[model samples]
Target: MLTQTLPTWLPRLSFAPVNTAPRGDTLVVVFLRGAADVLNMVVPHGEDAYYQLRPSLGIARPDDSKTKKEERTVDLDGFFGLHPNMSPLLEAWQSEQLAIIHACGAPDESRSHFKAMELMERGVDDERGPASGWIGRHLATLNTGNSSPLRAVGMGTRPQRSLSGSVPVSALRSITDFHLGGDLRALQQMRAALETVYAGDILGQETLSIMDTLQKLDVQNYQSPITNYPDTEFGLALKQTAMLIKAEVGLEVSAIDLGGWDTHFAQGSSAGIMPNLMKDLAEGLAAFHADMADHQNQLTTVTMSEFGRRASENGSLGTDHGHGSMMMVSAAMWTAAKSTGSGLGWRKVNSLGQVIWRSQQIIVMCFPRF
Candidate 1:
């Protein structure tokens, strides 16, 4: 259950958000905090160079007879394969609900975790750019009639920099914390007082409305009837986000974090530390996909990392920070090229830094229903 207690007086800075129909699907951005190894995550098994460089760390080919099932890659397109632990997503892959964008990343070329993440989150080429995030700008500009105070949410302690624009975003931890002392009379009295104090302000009204919205939800006790979600922090976050969406609380975008991808030490190839991380990720995602089965076409979940680790495994058995990154979109409405699997055109490149990281359309391109 959600445990953190946040003040209901979270800040917001915005003018009137034009009330209109939804512009698109609810977008959930899952940020893998530490630089993730996209090469390993989305294994390029057909590329011999991948195995040549990191023989010890590369996942075994799908057809490798001697490799354990847990160590072998789950064939996607013969060329690209998902790490074995991520096999749970095969449902989405085969169902054509998952689109993998390879080698997409910030062109800043900074390997420092903090700098790279800042640049990526801000959607800037370098440090001398706008402080607000791309998503922030999107929400600010789009006159989608989503007026729910919980419209844009940062799922943890602080809002992600990408959600740092002018349109008000709520930095929240738990919906349960807003239960208002668990005393109905006190809650009514407090609500009356707050309504009286914030009577004429738009932001205040929105804030009060958000409280009212959350008050009706039972998020902390939510349990998906169809999916047995993993009991991890990431899983719980996704679970609660699903609850908010189902409650129709006007949650447009949510930024959830799953850190510790900086596998500089003991970055397991198929069965160790890295695979464990992938298991947690895959299980949570699969469960979310199942739990939200009813709202398939209305939601889009995307995964990203600050940057990708080096292609070749280092002497320390882990990869170094590099520019190779990939993005994944799991949506029932994937409208991009019917990618049968090839790493070019709609691709993003190897962390080896040899291939040019050319850009291409991903989000809106695939968001046709939106």
Candidate 2:
């Protein structure tokens, strides 16, 4: 029952030479902890069926001039639009640096939060699958000369299941304190754990140097380019990720979580609870997008959740767990206009179970040859 609390940062620069892992863009994974009503985040205004199914929860169309800006969807591809609170991400979309993939599925069709999140993070469809996460497998299979302890980072009190595997991951509680002066005890403890891969002095020294590099950049006061990152926990996670990317500390991937997405009541169609969640998500991402302008070609940000909401709303004015969620990817490497996926067109099929499969591509694509 422990949790992470956040608004934090640091930065610099270094170009990776040839023959290193993650020659591709650094990956930042933003996971919505609870089952986010993705239908609201990525509005399907063009689909009349969507409106009829959740009339009370349906987002107003882009052309609803009478509606307040926060009451209408921001058109993305004419057919789909973003929730009003997600307006912050529009800039990335306008620049064609963002892609929207609709109707992704969960491994568990049963709609159990614990089950689906576990399977999704572990990158498996069932208990029979490997316990290690997809990112872990990626690191284990690809052996590039890069073995920095900071290679993989999970922002929280614990490393995400997706980060569990043969590879070592630093489950950081504070990005600002990821250095020797801050977590010496933890580092000393890690020394024993990583001694196999990192010779005693090597791990310590490498980590010291990385932190020193970060200290030199004064990451604690990093200046974002396009816009400032919000002072929220989610924003803090991203700011730290941005700092790491800018610092060039050999970071290939980082995972961040944003909770409170289970909107079973007062999910809000135009402005309220859920909209606020959208605001935080969109703002944090927008700020990161702005700060990452220079690193866009070498950075890919993706948002995901456990599952989607039911097409029908409950009497509580909220949504129940169903299936068929969606994911949004922001990257310069992304060229696809928008992924319609496979079964969403029918207006009912909950992806028939394709969420984990398709979303993995975005993650795998981050490592050039991995």
Best by lDDT: 1
Q: For candidate 1, lDDT tens digit of each residue in 1-370?
A: 2223422222221323434235335888899989888888888888876787787898899999998876798888878988888889888888888888886777766578898888878877778968998889877877766666678889887888989988888777777664457488887898898889988876677666656656656655566778778888898788878877765557888889999999989998866778889999999999999989888778889899887776678898988776657888898877542333355432335474443223432222123344
For each candidate in turn, the TM-score is 0.84, 0.82
Q: In model 1, which runs have C-alpha deviations exceeding 4 angstroms?
A: 1-24, 179-186, 198-206, 335-370
Name model 2 segments beyond 4 Å from true: 1-24, 181-201, 215-220, 339-370
lDDT tens readout by residue for model 2, 246-276: 6566788889999999999888877788888
lDDT of 2 at 33: 81
Which 10 consecutive positions of candidate 1 have the poorest summed lDDT? Answer: 6-15
Best by TM-score: 1
How far does residue 6 in candidate 1 sit from its true spot (Å)? 28
Model 2 CA lDDT for position 35: 88
Q: For candidate 2, what is the TM-score?
A: 0.82
What local distance difference test score does each model get? 0.75, 0.73
Distance from true position, residue 53, model 2, in Å? Answer: 1.7
